[model samples]
Target: MLDPRFLTIPITHRGLHAPGVPENSLAAARAAIEAGYGIECDIQPGPDGEPLVFHDYQLHRLTGAQGFIAATDAATLAGLRLLGTDEPVPTLRQFLDLIAGRVPLLIEIKDQDGACGPNVGTLPARVAEALAGYDGPVAVMSFNPHMIAAFREAAPHVPVGLTTCAFGEDDWARVPPARRDELAAIADYDAVGASFISHDKDDLDNPRVDALRAAGAGILSWTIRSLAEEQAARRIAQNVTFEGYRAAY
Candidate 1:
């Protein structure tokens, strides 16, 4: 269940990246808040191991740049402009400063491959440090179970969410049912410590949702783009993290 202390509509994906808004930019976050939406942004560690807000493994999609985020430093990232704005890539700390206390921040940590990987080793600590004194609801999420586990140990007080795609017995037919149950159990353990479960909207009816909710996890669905998907999510999720749509309800 969602902590009663936190607002119900905590935030939306990429902080309202619409036609005119640049995804993951402070300008976009501010726009979302101004229009009464909380903010959700992606966090990844740069080459220097600083937590920065970016979505893709490479910068080509958002910026015309041509390298992986992990290969660049903050200074270099700050030099290139995001596609739609003069604004450069904003560090997680800079993003927090912009949205501090104004609205809740949902930080989605990207997977940097494996346990003890350079990106995983340093980013979580930096994110925890950046949010040390912020007086608002802060949550961390990741598609990587190991990374989520690390966050649970590193920042216990700050809620964490386990992100999953829509895969089930039918999807994973080759895998043994026992293994699937074990994976689900691991996710439940993280959800028990997490604020919510952020998942792909299409997975609403997946058994994992029932399992996680039964274990007392709150539901948050992501990148909702259409009215039908949005309405479907409302029935299952406590909050919807979106990209194109500004108004959730």
Candidate 2:
């Protein structure tokens, strides 16, 4: 059976945030904990191979720094503040320590193209090591199917999933339409032993999503920004990985 814990909780994307608490910041994680919501965070590898709680490949978008996040060492990332906030970018171990299994965590292992950027084949093993004994209700997912397969081998007990979207014009320009179709279809679900799927909110019409849901696998929708959208998503999905606005569900 699917874990009732995941199905029952409303997941806050990049932690719960408002005003000064930046997304994926420890402060945001604390806020989510305080509000009693499941937390979602994205992980990328630092130059030292430590998994960092972050969302973007480039640091400039959140930190105003002029380099790739994967190029920065853990020590350098730990020292920098996020968008002038007091919160520094934290390692996965640090973030896990703060949570201390108090709330469920949905960790999104980020990737570029088909691999985990510069980390390549090492990220899954690193993340598995960090999460080795964590007692929290945690799951890992990635937009890259190969990453999911890699992580599955690294942590067989941890629930792994695929995060996919139906391609828009911009997304199609980047990845060929044929590739997008394959992704949306979740071609690797069986291969990776995926327990859930976090799909794009705009792309809920996907047949693979329907097939998974029909087969009783968990289905979560991403980046729901409003109560209406959350409600709309809940009609098809079991839960939402939400952000921007507080989720009422």
Candidate 3:
């Protein structure tokens, strides 16, 4: 369970998108706010260096467009419609404006390594600028520890969370088993330095979660879709990520 002292809840993944609402679009965020749920969405830099809300490396999956999100400018992305909706790919600022202090926001920085890498250079600063003076609670989350570190430096007041996923046997097969603990320890340490840890549901059972909580770090779990998973997450975390089930408590 989340610490009763802090204002928090199970944030909706990509803002409560369902059969009607498009994931990561402004409409989805609006739906989340209308349902009184906190919003969690992804941020990536467009080719023109603007911050846009999107989750995938390529636009083809969500939008019918080819190439990566970073390959296009905001104007081009704005022209493309999101799947199942007429909503254009909205900028992070636009999404925030749509929410309009109705709910808190959890912004995730999506960075898959490549020529585009993560939006490391100016992304943090832009996000900070957009969030400046906003009254609602806001926390920045990222899979990349460096991005969290940069956010910490750029916006000291805004809380940051580190997102991690457990490795499977196939993952272990690629990397030596001996080094996994060392890497996990490093990530745990980094997460501790940040204000919170946003990990998968299974991570709640890990000793590191207790260790971080003991140190006063906030804990959050991601992408929970079932009642059983939500119950499990409630038992172990301060918050859980949600989608599809709007009426769920």
Models, CA RMSD each: 3.6, 2.1, 3.4
Candidate with the larger lDDT of 2 and 3: 2
TM-score of each: 0.85, 0.93, 0.86
- The whole-model lDDT of each prediction reads 0.73, 0.84, 0.73
Which of candidates 1 and 2 reaches a greater TM-score?
2
lDDT of 1: 0.73
Worst 10 residues of 3 by lDDT: 110-119
Among residues 3 or more apart in sequence or in different chains, the pairs in candidate 2 whose N, CA or C atoms overlap within 3 Å are: none
What C-alpha lDDT, on a 0 to 100 scale, does residue 213 get in candidate 2? Answer: 92
Ordering by TM-score? 2, 3, 1
* Ranked candidates, highest lDDT first: 2, 3, 1
The digit string of per-residue lDDT tens for model 3 on 129-222 reads: 7888876767887766667677678778887777765644464444345544544553544543577777788667778787878787787787
Q: Candidate 2 — which residues are off by over 4 angstroms?
A: 113-119, 172-176
Q: Pick by lDDT: which candidate is best?
A: 2
The residue-level lDDT of candidate 1 at 121 comes to 78
